[model samples]
Target: MKGFFFFLCFISFSAFCLAQQAYPAAAPLPKKNISIFGRGLYPGDDATYELLKKSGFKTLLLSSFYIHADGDLYSGDSHLPIIHNGKWVGDSAYVVRVKNLKKHSSISRIEILLEGRWYGQPPNTFDFIRDWYDPSKTVPGIVTGIGEQSTLFNICKVLKEVLGADAFCIDDESVYDSPSIIAMGKIAAKLNMHMTLCPFTKYSYWGDILRASDEKVVDALYLQCYDGGARNDIKDWVTALKPQQPIYPIFMVRGSFGTCDSYKGSKSVDEIRAQLKGFKSDYPAMSGASIWQMDDVKKFVSMGCAVKNPASGTATDVAQFLKQLKTTFKREL
Candidate 1:
């Protein structure tokens, strides 16, 4: 009986050891959050979402929400109509996918990015705001577009209630009208939505908006460290903004448009690492970093960039880029 019992114990112990070896403990979750701009993700697929879900990004800034020349609001470069006059025109599938990402993934926060850049004409959104926003007029009490609702208010309402957005991101590259931005910020605040800045230049303009706004309204600053802002130093922005919220430096990746060369703010994994390290060294308090947009990430995967393993597709490419950001900002051992 004693010999039989010993034999059983030996077998059980060996099995336990093998089980431990086979299923190692999960790695500790990274301390800092990483953010990404979503240009292509509004209509993205399951495969892309799966990779993004596991990509260690916590914030998803849905990009390029534009207020057209006419008061309609649209998303993405194709200008997929989202709101018209005062009604939801966005596809239900887009809404479902975005909401699902928040529900099932590590992406806890989703911000509607209102981008205004001079492509050919003045940024239509900011120009619209400047023209339409009447500070002399009192903001409407009922936000539900019942009566006397500004187009901006209706847009905010959809972004908050229908889209389930956490915040509104301001990326005003041109048309730095302080009153328009400040007024819009106040409106967003009233809607109980936070506002974040994506500034590439005009420190005083951003500073003016920050100073005039409520402390709770503006929560984070995502400084562009690429393209026109390539010369931007993290420390300078930190000092200028005097931000109460975390400042994340946004990096443009090299795989944009299927080209590996660093141009127009795109950097390789190594360059990104070195830059991130330098930024961290300069400002250790930086909570996270951001990649510009998903369109480039997809382009990188699809256009046959130098990804060592193509079998994994977007997952492999995204992991390669995001791994560098996450590792650089990861907490000390």
Candidate 2:
């Protein structure tokens, strides 16, 4: 009886040791948030939304409106449009459209893209005068100057009040003067909205611009990573600017400038993918990546942008790729 009791105790101790060894303590997993930007130029149609859902995207950066040539604001245009279920709704009807989308779709977060004149110029007053003066006459021209500051301020106020946007993206950096950028940041903070500054190149005074803006108000820094030029530029920029700030890397799948230049030698999806894969492998500190202008991707593929084994299917192909990334990385979308 004594021998049997001793044997049972030994067995129990061995089982406990094995259990502790098999189930070693592990570290907590990091949270990953995937966001995509939708250009009003292309508008998020049913197909786009379907792709987003399949790709496991939880947030959308939407282009909401733009300043028109007539010193007036227009909603639905090449730059800004109100799209619902793939249909174009008028600009004045953005609030209703966004509400409906939230109610019907799986979109939880909305970031509005606020665009103005290319170089911080006020809307063209001559165009307004011509349009109002004569119905059948083309507007000649107008000087765009500092009046843009007031116009931008007014536009920001109206957008926050009407659209109830959670965040805003400053699409044009030419207009991002220190004072104007800081003022916009203040307005965003008052309205409880986050701000994203899209810096296309390292030469742009983004660091100074961001510094002028309220640090608490700015949420993320969006770096346009398109060509090899951008790759080197962004890596250096991030290294210099990684001071408790989130950096969002934006990749352009198709565009006029960088896409043509970078992919000229190798004209295949595999080639493009290889370039991106190398970039990610080299620079693993990127917060997240978003592809530029979805329509451009479609256009490129249609225009024979693929290499040897052409990437087939619609934007769905890109979505699947993103989903696979999430699974492989063990990251949340």
Candidate 3:
């Protein structure tokens, strides 16, 4: 009897060890919060900015920081001034307009984007510094080149000093290595800037990026749900990404750009609510919803919220609608 009992105990212990080796412990749940991204590449005046600021989003990401061949970032045609070689340059009126937003807008943090439309051939906005992958290596987190690191650091400093932008959002399609991504994130954080990931692809080290930056300055991951990413299920994304920071699933508004036309924003409060309700059921921990462009906020509000008059005034209706949306999404972490 004693020999049989010992043999059974040994088998049980071995099984336990194997199970532990097979399945790692689950990661801690992500924080709950909301975020927004804006390319600032739209036509408009202060009224446009005013309307967007009024909408309820925690952080406003000013996007399209086009990087040139020489590791320089340009704002393209943003409403805010772009930092170029340590100096902020843009139209004086537009610069003042953006400064006013900083003064009056209720937004808490501002982030600069590192993705944009390609200018032409090599080293354009979209095709800049994409090659950080080394196929010879097994690890997917090592950045082979250090030049991209310097450029990222410079972008961080200029944005922070000139526009008070202490946050950054990277649509990093170039290199998915953990060592390099984590190192770059550390540099940005060291420079007093919060780093965020904009995951729009099925492949790429999304989870690895989160794990590496969990201990560092990575703040949030905004998963793309519009256009090509529209078919991506939120539950699957949450499982795959296992993000450390809050995850805000983003949607699209009707427009004629690249993939913007893929999904169209419509005027049905219940329909929109139903779609988001499904997301809530699947990802109760999600902070909130984000739109692609800045103008989309107003579009969603006007359509879903049913703005009575176009020219008369739409701010009040949009504000009320956004308030309801925010309340629905403020999930406990």
Candidate 4:
């Protein structure tokens, strides 16, 4: 009986050690040159990848992946599961282009963004996490029900194996459940992918997740400095999570809903420069900055979204817009 008890104890200890080993301490934050959101990137053509290869960005965060009912995952506007029952069912072109882009581009890291709330739509991804995450069955560094049969785990696996993703960015706007996010961080760790927080508000909620999980897994914070997060101050976040993890502010350029200056977060190039200067002044160790997306860039050009501030530039093309944005980040911050 004593030997039996010792054997059980040994097994438990080994499991604990294996769990810790699964997610080692996160490495130091990389010095970000520029991280851009690719909302219109997946369906892009060879020209798009060519343009992106020369875009001078270090990270490309594919925006807004959703998990629909019954563990079906979707990206952008496709009505089918990109991953169903642990198999890739989406278009092969996307995977091929992404691989080629990474192989021949300045992009060193590619992250898939799991977002809540889409253009005033329901928060499907967060809802899925809420319903599917079995907190009562969790262990020290991992969660139960996030295994082979789990949709969450399957999606993470496909994103890592198929998409070659380096990390998962959590944009939990509505659901502030720390346990669910911590569970996701652990799952990401299990797949050897890091988890990043994209929080516009609810600093305490994010703080709770960071404190609960290993810092290496939940390594970076991308603060949205646009739209609803227009009033967000960078100093507060820097103060809260500096030296441990790096903080990068994300900005939305002037172009969305076919209006430039009308959008509250939409800023002219000069405005962005000034804002970046202000952020740098507040925190000198600020990691870097990111642009919201590429779809808006096209909308601004095609919809004749005239320059609100003529002094900014006379350029009205997509190339000009991207160039100006890349130049602003390179020169300002």
Candidate 5:
């Protein structure tokens, strides 16, 4: 009887061990693919497309507004002349040119920038400008305060119709109120658009509201990684938010008090890689990254970095670098 009892005990122990080995608490899901966006109005030229494809960019974030143009700051329209000297001309022709290049390029996604606030218009009545301009004014104009509800809906309608962009980026740098942020997200979802909220680092107070808004309507979060202090500090900021939402680090290559300008830091490519690397180490939730500009990269290389223009680099160089970068830090999805 003792010998039989020992034999049964041995079998039970072996089965338990085997079961534990077979399923060692499934490991956490791996991070998602790293996405990069090129800022500025994508010229869609052969060179731009080729360079971007070579650099391993899967998505291009094309800007509709000339941010630096001398005009009403709230004006979202591209000032590039549509007509000159009785000839229908300017960027429209370039648009066709770019579309052709994109057809044959390796790029798979395109996200057009849609400005949230109207330039020169008072914040409250900004939404009415579009309706006022519209021959059929479905939205009645009214003088109201900056954070009105009706204006928010009208802005959403304009963005859906005029921009027709894949993603809607909220460029309201000044306003960080929760109600406005949530309203924007709600409207974006209604229009079947993904929302990328841009919140400045100076007002860290808004972090909580931003976090709350993320829970509601925000699809992606873009923290301006410039003008603030240290680049590494961004890691901490991102951590504090504990955002499960997709976060895209916007690397500033040019402009005032930007990372590249003040730090005299890494080459544009290196800066992009470094920021993404830092985000990965600190926050596993980070989805991808986007550069403040393509043109700035070119300008920086030409003026500051002794390297050849990114556009002038060999196609092989662009492709190899991008392939290696993506391969080295590929996420599961």
Candidate 6:
């Protein structure tokens, strides 16, 4: 009995040591590898990140960095530009918020998602889209013209030096063309910033971008499978794209309030676990997992249509769900 017990102890210790190296830890990480926790926070809702640290979610995908027709930049909810005229023009409050987020938080990595799609806008107006543009146009833009390219390069440099973000994730749902995506990746590399791609449904389009950005240009791919994208199957994606980069599958929460999507939503933590299992079974090579948010805690369990309603969900519920996810990955991998 004693000999067997000692054998079990030795195995346990070895496993623990292995996990320690790969588990979530603070920033300035030693020889950074693919992060296990890749979380997205809505442009204004940062409250959930405080609770999220408990689950070891260290990567913050701060979003909606809005670019303008004139190569200007803004955070989604905050209309004021953070960059302008090839400079970090962020106001005092904006600067403080970013500095404070890094200084007093567990986040070691922060990446802003570029959001520049106007679902229904005139063709003449520069959409701040993913294409080299005609500089003569009245509107300024990103990835277009020599001036626009310079402006984007400056924007990336400022994000690195002033705000201390590591990468830029393109939310180019309405990208003008493929090369523009690659151009953004090249510019990010020139500034020593990692390029991340966030795509839904159009795997072929994103797959091409991923190939162009991998290793030398891009570092991560965040694929969404919810709402209009609910039809996206992880297995199909893996077979089709065969991405060489780490894929951090992102799931839409806010499922309870129909805040994002209701179709195929996980109504409870149990459902989340099951869905995660299914995802893993399909794409076993996934580097990690990302939640679309931390801000949504059980806001409405008893509201909305019964079929579409996640009647008993909360933010803590989401955190607990992540805790389980971390444990499962640790054990399996």
| lDDT of model 2, residue 140 | 40
Worst 10 residues of 6 by lDDT: 23-32
* lDDT string, candidate 3, 1-333, tens digits: 999999999999999987644221211123334455665533247776675577555666776666665445666555243545535564556555555554555565677777644234345443434433222333232323333344545656666665666567777554344565665576565665677778767444777767766444777777777655666667887777666566677755443142222243322333345567788788876666665665555554445323443422233454554554455445321
Global Cα lDDT for candidate 4: 0.77
Please say which candidate is ahead in TM-score: 5 or 6.
Answer: 6
Best-performing candidate as measured by lDDT: 4
Predicted candidate 6 versus true structure: per-residue lDDT over 180-299, tens digit per residue? 677677666566667787777677788887776646457677777664556666777778878776666666554433443444553344445566678878777655666555433333
* Highest TM-score against the true fold, candidate: 4
Pairs with backbone N, CA or C atoms under 3 Å apart (clashes), candidate 5:
54-318, 74-118, 74-119, 75-119
Query: CA lDDT of 94 in candidate 5?
Result: 46
Q: Which model is ahead, 4 or 6, in terms of lDDT?
A: 4
- Tell me which residue pairs clash in candidate 4: 26-216
TM for every model, in the order presented, reads 0.81, 0.61, 0.68, 0.85, 0.58, 0.71
User: Candidate 5: misplaced stretches above 4 Å?
Assistant: 1-39, 42-46, 64-91, 94-106, 114-164, 202-217, 229-232, 254-276, 307-333
| Prediction 3 TM-score vs. true | 0.68
Which candidate, 2 or 4, would have the higher TM-score against the true structure? 4
Model 2: per-residue lDDT, tens digit, 1-333?
Answer: 999999999999999887644221211111343455665433345555556555555456665355555344555334333332223344444455554444544455667765555455664322232232322333444222223333333454455556556677776634444444555565566555667777765444567656666555676776666543354445667666653456655655542333432342322333345544554565666445555554545455444433422442222344544454334333311
| Candidate 3 wrong stretches, greater than 4 Å | 1-32, 41-44, 76-81, 102-104, 116-122, 125-127, 130-149, 173-179, 255-270, 297-333
lDDT of 5 at 272: 51
Q: Output the lDDT of residue 307, model 3.
A: 44
Candidate 4 ranges beyond 4 A from true positions: 1-29, 118-123, 135-144, 240-243, 306-313
